[model samples]
Target: MEGYAKLSSLISTDSEFAMYRKFGAQNTQSLLCYQAELISFGDDLQQLAASDRRSQDTDKRLHAENWYELSRVENGKDQQIKKFDKIRKDNCLIQQTAIAKLDRLAPYNLRNLRRWLTRSAFGSSFLYGLEARAWDEVYDHDLLAFPRSYAENDKDALPQLFLGPLLELFHNLIGRLYKKGTTKDTLSPEPLIRYYDSNILRVADILITIISSGLPIASITALNYINRTITRLVVVAVFTVTSSLFLTFLTSLRRTENFAVTAGFAAVQVVFVGTATGAGNGGLLRSDV
Candidate 1:
């Protein structure tokens, strides 16, 4: 009776159990009845252990099935690519559902679920192929599930889903830089840099914004401010260096020109640089200079 009362009190008071009640009332009742039976069989220690194992196995299967249902992709044309793209677009919804399902499980069950996901082929591919926005969603969800402070104390408490996706996105960005041209055998930095600056960097900025927003203002010490300032300076320095190199390349291309053509090429370079600088500065600044 004492054991049953304690179990009842825990089920009533624990938030995790509360979620279980909300989503799986039948399972909750079955768990309670199973516990009652274990308590009644006070001398049968073997039976108690066997029953507990069975209960744990059932919970693991239930949680695994729930997650699989939410994440599984349907078969269709270009199925693999389409499935992954759909998963990325629906990442927010999947995160919500997965978290809710996770909340209903015990810590051991949670570990089992994570193990199941990590071992599954579809799960591995889905995580490794996540794009920028999808990776952001997963990162955010991981942070929420296991904050830095909590993760410091318990390393394996939460799933490490963010790392694979982040690495995959980085790898994809690098691969995009070396795309082969059909006509010319020459490698072009212009298209590569443009794509990098516009897509990958833009996504990186968004991730930074998300991280920054979560940081406490009180934690913004002088060192933190200085670091941010130094980062901005570094970015400016890189921009200046790249711009100078591009100008040098343009000038070198005009080395074979006659005097008039060289003058015209220099003038054109000046106009092009002015236009580019204006556009780079948000196109609102005057181009008079």
Candidate 2:
């Protein structure tokens, strides 16, 4: 019995025995860490894929809504146009009133009025300090509110109210991953995955909003670039044609009997060449021609 107790104590307290157990624990912890990393990466990839799908669906929905709104607005075109005309008249009256009020306040002459209109905040401003109540009274009476409201809401509210939270959520997710990788603590990916799944729709909303907003700006920029390129090409073609005609005229005159005429033509050719090559009057000489 004493020998048995001694053997048990040796097995329990021996450094080698303790080391063996410690090695097993370490291996188990390492496995868990590896498992966590793999799971986190897989989950993140799956979430991203799911978010992309949701974004596509959201994009479709927004497109459908835009078409629907556009159609609705189009259907009421005559009434909306008439309402716009009325608003324009009202705005003119308001501007006249503002000008009169300013004149009364300052006793300005015609020249001063012209200067003030050019320099004053009222002339440069949209609505010109018009109150919301006044705007509503002038513009909103008997008009279908849906079209204007829809456009304004989509332009102003969707990006900030709808996408802002999703951006913050994505940032939080990235920070969580970074923290997990850098920290020494044993962390499970399950909770993070759950959180991502819950917020995937919000992420999709953000992506859709960004895509929609960016597309219009991108299209406009491309259109402007194309327009500028076309204008430059037209200008160059015109300049080339004109120069060719002038050179042909000069060539015809070279065979003429009049030496003075030939000499004058040569002088004009020199001036033309100099102007075309940007030697005189900067680049404006080409435009002058």
Model 1, span 1-289: residue lDDT tens: 2222432343343222221222234444655665565455443534433453465555433432354532343453322334345434634434444545442223332332233234422122224442412223233323222222222212221111122244345546774567542311122111111122235334544554553343223122222343334453444444434434433432333334334443443454344444545455664455545
Task: Write down the lDDT that model 2 would get.
Answer: 0.36
Report the Cα RMSD per candidate: 28.8, 37.1
Question: What clash pairs does model 1 have?
Answer: none
lDDT of 2 by residue, 122-202 (tens): 222122343312223233222121111122223233333332454446656675565433211122111211132225445
Assess every candidate by TM-score.
Answer: 0.16, 0.16
Clashes of each: 0, 0
- Candidate 2 lDDT for residue 227: 30
Q: Give the Å error, residue 124, model 2.
A: 74
Angstrom error at residue 121, model 1: 13
